[model samples]
Target: AQSVTQLDSHVSVSEGTPVLLRCNYSSSYSPSLFWYVQHPNKGLQLLLKYTSAATLVKGINGFEAEFKKSETSFHLTKPSAHMSDAAEYFCVVSARAGGGNKLTFGTGTQLKVEL
Candidate 1:
């Protein structure tokens, strides 16, 4: 079984500051981790993904995450925050099941960017 936990329920940052969002996961096998963002009344967008390729994965919008197997963590970070970056972020974990794959999502973390 695979599961994900988002450590923060809400994260607030001033514009041009750094942003960090923590995530932890547990999986029986090597899991596929992803960070997704959702805007108001918009569908989820893939921010980044880790499929066991590289330790450091870069995504859109100046965001990146490092997959640390020893720490069981995949935390998202941005060099500078922007008002347009305010959105709900979700940490997702997926693993192969008996016949198919199953995905587990963590509780969403809302990011608020203040001008």
Candidate 2:
């Protein structure tokens, strides 16, 4: 079984400041971790992903995350925040299923950026 836990339900930051969102995961096998952002009434967009190739992975919009197998963690971070960054973020975990893969999504972290 695989599961993901988002440490925070909401995170607020001022524009130009840094942003951080924490996540923890559990899996019996090596799991693929991903961060996705969803804006108001918009489709979900992939922010970053860890597919067992690199421990530290970078993604679009100046976002990055490091996979810590020992700690069972994959936390997302950004050097600077933007107003457009305000959205709901999800930490997802995927592992091998019967014949394919199963994806489990975190509850979500809503980001609010203020000027």
Candidate 3:
């Protein structure tokens, strides 16, 4: 079984400041890790994915994560925050190779931005 734990359930930031969200995972097989963002009344948009090949992965909206096998962690980071970046973030895991693209979502980390 594979499981993902998002360290923060909420993050608050001032506009233009950097954003960071922490996540950790446990997987039996080689895992595909993804960070997704959701705006109000919208579906999730893929932020990035970490395949076994790359340690550092970049995604849309200036989000990025590094797959650290030694730490069992995949943490999302952004250099700046915008009001538009205020949304719900999810740490997702899939055992697609073993179980298919069925996704298991984290509880969610709500990002709030101040002007």
Candidate 4:
């Protein structure tokens, strides 16, 4: 199975500033990675994903991530921070190589945006 680690438990940014949520992955094979966001009192929504195709994957709401093989990292970033972007972000990896094609999620990073 693949393991994912979110580097930060919480990240705070001012409005209009850049946002970054770091994630590192470990797997025996090239596994699929995804980023999901959950707003306050809302369900989780897909943000972005990387599946061995292009290293740079663009997702919804102006969010994007670059998969770096050498570094084993897939960090999410946005050029500007919005108040509505405050949410919990999860990093997920596929466990297909291990047996079943299930998605395993790691700890989430809570983002806070201030005025």
Best by lDDT: 2
Question: In angstroms, what RMSD does candidate 2 have relative to the true structure?
Answer: 0.8
Model 3: lowest-lDDT 10 consecutive positions: 95-104
Tens-digit per-residue lDDT, 1-115, candidate 3: 8898998999999999999899999988888889999999998899999877779998998888999999999999899998999999999888775555867788889999999
What is the lDDT of every predicted structure here? 0.96, 0.97, 0.89, 0.93
Task: Give the per-residue lDDT of model 2 (tens digit) for 25-115.
Answer: 9998889999999999999999999999989999999999999999999999999999999999999999877999889999999999999
Candidate 1: residue 40 lDDT (0-100): 96
| lDDT tens digits by residue: candidate 4, 9-88 | 99999999999999999998888999999988999899988988999999999999999999999999999999999999
Residues 7-112 of candidate 1: C-alpha lDDT, one tens digit per residue: 9999999999999999999999998999999999999999999999999999999999999999999999999999999999999999887899788999999999
lDDT of 3 at 30: 83
Q: Given candidate 1, what's the lDDT at residue 103?
A: 83
Which residue runs does candidate 3 get wrong by more than 4 Å?
97-99
Q: How many backbone clashes does candidate 4 have?
A: 0
Any idea what lDDT model 3 has?
0.89
Output the TM-score of candidate 3.
Answer: 0.93
Candidates arranged by TM-score, highest first: 2, 1, 4, 3
lDDT, candidate 1, at 79: 94
- For candidate 1, the clash count comes to 0
